[model samples]
Each structure stands twice: as C-alpha cells, then as structure tokens.
Target: MAGLTAAAPVGQPQMLTVVLEGLRSHKGQILVCVTRSADHFPDCTKDPDKRHFAVPVKNGPIPLGTVAPGDYAIAIVHDENGNGKLDTFMGIPREGVGFSRNPVLRFGAPSFGSASFSVAGAPVEQAIRLKYFL
Candidate 1:
C-alpha cells in the first residue's frame, strides 16, 4: 500500500491529494506525515495518531489512503536515500522538505497553524514545494 490509514474512522472517508513539487531527484521515496496535533506539526514520530504515507518518487497525485474529515497539517521529506528519516547535518536538512501550505523555511518546520489545512467531506488538494538546504 502507499499509505497508512486510520484504523477506525471518526467521520466520512475522504481523500487527500498531496502534490509534491520541486523534486531535485526521483531516486528514493517520499515520506509523508499528517497530523492535527500542534506539538507534532513537523516531525510526527511521537504522534501516535499521525498518518503516514510512503510513495514512490514518480507520481501524479500521491494516494494517502483514507482519512476522516477534519483539520490536518502535513510534513513531507524527500528521502532521496530511503533512510526512512529526514537526514540532516548540523540541524539543517540534507534532503528536500516541504509543508502543506508551502510555508516559509526557517530554522525549523513551520508551526501547525502555518501548514494546516481543512479536509472536508469533499476531496482536498495540497500543493507543497520541496526545499533543499544542504
């Protein structure tokens, strides 16, 4: 499968179209994390309820499986090495990274409010442009 969906849904099943842009290379995998928790806005490894999607580099619209209609924030990492984690050097990302709203890049990932978007019963689209800072 391309994504990890919620086990038991809360509301209607909805689809989220995540459009990744500015990919430097199509070598490895695309690791995505979706969460509504402010504390887990970017790195959601601690967010137990977070949704994960691992899609191949070549794509049209990433299939993030099914999700409940609600508010969510997304963080993406182009794992060009397929290391399963965002490889960073001196706290700076060595790979490409992006957020749902294409928030400005700073010392760290944007706050939840900056990258968050609403997922209504209808399908929603998120166009995120990747950034590389090596």
Candidate 2:
C-alpha cells in the first residue's frame, strides 16, 4: 500500500465580502462593521469583529473575511482624515458613509432591518454605494 495519509480537511471560515463603490477620493481608511445586533448597527465600538481597510482616495471594493455566516447589517465610513472616526458637521456627516442595501438617508441612519442581509454557509458579497455630503 502506498503512503496511507489521513488528514482532516480544513473548513473554510464563514465570511462576508463587502464591495464598496463611489469612494470619491483615495485618501482615507474605510471603517466597516458587521453587526448581528441592531442595538449597535452603525457604531461598531460594541462589535469586536469590525474590519478596517485603507483604501485609495479612489473607488474600489473591500472584502471582509472575519465575519461568520449569519444575518448581519453593515455600515461603512470613509475617514478621509485617517482620524479613525466619522466626522459630522452640525448633526450631519461630513465624510463619505454608506450602509448595506444602500438605503436612503432621511433624518438619521437606517434601521438595522433595513440594512440587514442574510449570509448562509456560502460567501456573501454586499455592494454598498458610498455617499458623501461634503
């Protein structure tokens, strides 16, 4: 018998890919948060699995590989100043920001349900269009 080798097959980590477009500029870091809870929809301070990507001031797509397969909502902010925080002017955002499903921003951020998407065992790709107010 040839070399009988038995190795446990490694399973792929469940993850969600976010394709960000309309970046407008290429001079900041993109802060992406995947949340399974509505209580912390946009603010990812409570989420320990937030993914941050440094993108050019140009438009591109970002993939997040740290998320598990489950229902989750996504929020992204382009910190042009690299301050690691979303800048707002008079209760309005001054930088590029967007959410999953590309929900229209009315008075405030979209609800968790409005920006939520289901992720099964397969890899999921979410396309979000970044919007800037400045």
Candidate 3:
C-alpha cells in the first residue's frame, strides 16, 4: 500500500481578489487599500503592513493578488474626472466610489469595521458596487 504525504498546514497565506463593479465611468482610477493593521479608519496614510495597489481603470475588475490572510478593507474611488483624488463637494463625493461588502454607505465613507472582512487559508472573491451622486 502506498502512503500519502502529510498535507500542508491549514494556516497558509492566501490571496483575496477584489472585484470593483458598476463603475459610473471608466475614465478615472481605482485604488485598493488593504492592510492587516486596523489602528485607524482608512489607514492608508501609514505604510501598509501588507500590500496596496492602485490601478488605472478602463473598466471591469482589477485583481490584487497574493494578499495575506487576515482582516482587510477595500476602498475604491472612481475619479471620473481623473483628478487623482476623490473629489468632494460640501462633504459629499463628486465622483463614484465603493467599499467592500457594499456596506450601507452614509453621508461619507463607512468605518473600517463596517467594510472589513476576513480571508482564511484559501483565496476569496468580493464584488463592490460603485456608489455615485450627481
């Protein structure tokens, strides 16, 4: 009888692919903010403990790969005007934006916990619906 080798440990690192959809327009950019450190909401200011990727959008999902397994939040801004930043007017975003899990977005961006989710030993998929206001 042949004996099988032991399998790898269950806690191996994995990637979490996030898909941003329903973009109002494809003329802008897409920024993905991911981290295991949750010291602050939208904690993009400090150097991310893991990975961060910003992709110019022409349309459709932008894949961010090889992300470690842990808590993470995905924030995306559809800068329709190509301003290189989220344009806001009177405390409201002038461009389309999105968050992971599609949490109930209020007058402004949602808190880190509201948009956070866990990735375990295997890859995960998520789709965020873009929010827009004229």
Candidate with top TM-score is 1
- Candidate 3, residues 1-134, lDDT tens digits: the string is 47955433457766567777787666757766776655644536575474555688755546677665578887777777766677888878888778888999877778878888888766667898888876
**lDDT of the candidates, in the order given:** 0.86, 0.77, 0.72
lDDT of 1 by residue, 2-91 (tens): 795544344676787888889999999999999989998788888999987688997578878766778899999999999888998999
Give per-residue CA lDDT, model 2, range 1-134, as digits (tens). 69965432234446567778887777877877778888888886776655544544445445677565567888989898989888999989999899999999888899999999876546667889888987
Steric clash pairs (candidate 3): none
Please tell me which predicted candidate would have the highest lDDT against the true structure: 1
- Comparison by lDDT, 2 against 3, better one: 2
Model 1: colliding residue pairs: none
TM values, all candidates: 0.87, 0.80, 0.81
> By the lDDT metric, which is better: model 1 or model 3?
1
- TM-score sort, best first: 1, 3, 2
Clashes of each: 0, 6, 0
Point out the worst 10-residue segment of candidate 3 by lDDT: 1-10
